[model samples]
Target: MINTKKIWYLLAAMAVILITTVALMSNKKEVEKTPKNPYQAIDGAKTNSYEPVGESLELTTDDNVIGNKKAELIVFVYEDYSSPYSAVLAETLSRINSELDNKLTIAIRPFVTAGNNISREGALTLMCAQDEGKFSEMRNVILAAAKEGSLQEGGFNVYANQLGIDETAFNNCLTNEEKSLKLEAIMAEADKNLVIGAPTIFIANEMIIGARPYSDFVDSNGDAVEGLKAVVDRQLSAVGTKK
Candidate 1:
């Protein structure tokens, strides 16, 4: 006579309410949580990223070139001097350039990640070297040293001295604010060109990402060098014909 059916109905309604409340609380907890890696970047790439670059970066002239400027083929790369893969891709590109007899005009530009003091300083030194017309020597020496150890270890100055760069002038120019603007411009350019990673290369409309091993590597374009060389040769032929 205690109305058993009504009691069951009431208990069932209470159970449903409790389940829904638990679910809502769980979802709310999830919404308020933050990620452990809260880095905010333009491209959202991780900080501490570094790599190698340049046909060598020439800071003195806006026109930094690695090969024939008037040539039909041009290779553009965005690299960091401290990245091993950048070094590898750079070596590959250098080999390809040499094999092609410097027909390609290669341009190296900065695309720095945050928290890299050496990269920023190295870039500054490279610009000074460009001013002194010693970009090649300083870049090679500093990069070699950077590959082995650090670029902010005061070695760039030694290389600059060895290469006969005006020590006082080079040192004085290191703190220029314009260099930061230039660095930002390079990064923006890379972003515009859809460069999301280090060691990105462009040949005509074709895009090459990362390093290409001579023997064991392959991509969508058949053989790396052979296919690339074919493209270069065709472009060279076309340029020669036009001329």
Candidate 2:
């Protein structure tokens, strides 16, 4: 006594269930792919509404830092060396460091998610130079090399020699497996922080995306633009007021 209509209805219900399950899974994946704080179409500074990253954003003893390490205003920079926009941001940060003097610290957290060999290699170069206490010098040289497309030609050795880093040590550090693991850890840390792209900056609780110029730091009388400099100035002023 096979119930043909009942079997047909059962199959139809199963098919509907399967389709719904698949759709739910697809939606979940899309949601996961979306950044925690989705980027807005507007330019300039994007305020981060989340609490401070706490220990995750804190600088370690191994960090490549410029300016006073203990400065109240520490600008955390997560950048890929191969990115032109990151290079521009690097220049802007350096200028800010010089202009602000010891008012702030720039902590560079290098990552290689740029999807290129040059980015990975550049990070390794910076880390290797860091081992020799030459990170600041190597950072400038490697960024310039990345911008000029010279890193692809393997100019690290020449740069190392020029910068007075021990050539043998630098080469050994470059080939070390531990350095690669360290970089992977750095990338994972960035992912955990919801970093969606290179050159993501964390100034206080604010997260700024893309490259910003010094002028963008302040509003112009003729033109309107919000910039990093403005943000930094505000943070600095706040800390000064607190003190």
Candidate 3:
């Protein structure tokens, strides 16, 4: 009778230990399965605000012209070559230019987003094309290829050839240190402007921060005149305040 009692007590203790162990493991798994906040995940990559204080800088190549210039209207675009949103914005700008009869002057600056996707080589290739006066054509080809999802290995070279850019010159430019520095400077300037994402558009002084619909630019009359007027008014207001 005493031996039976001892066995019963031992079994109860063993059962309690097992239950406690299982509960701890279950609680651990629940802790591990908790979801993370998406916005908090990107906290390390935020851009710092920078204002260009003097005369606007310009980058000129034989094929492309980019910079701060006085015009009836100035559209500043911050783009990343590997970003789909940027590609769409490029297409929209092309369409707008065609429909508006060249009423807008556009300035494009490169902002690197994808890790080593739009590299120094890519930027130099663009600059070389600009030197050859084939910047727009080359840009269109690249954007179209990106839209088609074809920018794999050696694809940029193929597109350059398609746009009639001299492949040898492009290759040389891609490896040139001076050209690399220029691209780095452009990227730094983009960083200074607090460009946090690809396809950030600035019309006059107003900023539109994403790949929004083209219709966003149209007014009630199905024309972009109102949009242009808004930009003009903002610019005038800025000038008045400066004085």
lDDT of 1 by residue, 1-243 (tens): 889999999999999999999999999899789445322221211222123222333323464677777666666777766566676666676776788888888877655656776666777787777777877677677667656665554556777788887788878867778766777777766676567667676664445566545334344566324333454455567667877
Each model's TM-score, in the order given?
Answer: 0.66, 0.74, 0.61
Q: Which pairs clash (backbone N, Cα, C closer than 3 Å) in model 3? A: 62-130, 62-131, 63-130, 63-131, 63-133, 64-130
Compose the digit string of candidate 3's lDDT tens values, residues 208-241: 5666455425545664432333333445456658
Off by over 4 Å in 2: 1-56, 217-224
- Residue 18, model 2: lDDT of 100
RMSD of each: 8.6, 6.1, 9.0
Which of the numbered candidates is closest to the native, going by highest lDDT? 2
- Best candidate, TM-score: 2
| Candidate 2 TM-score to native | 0.74
**For model 1, how big is the CA root-mean-square deviation?**
8.6
The best-first sequence of candidates by TM-score reads: 2, 1, 3
* CA lDDT, every model vs. true structure: 0.64, 0.77, 0.62
Name the regions of candidate 3 deviating beyond 4 angstroms: 1-70, 217-243
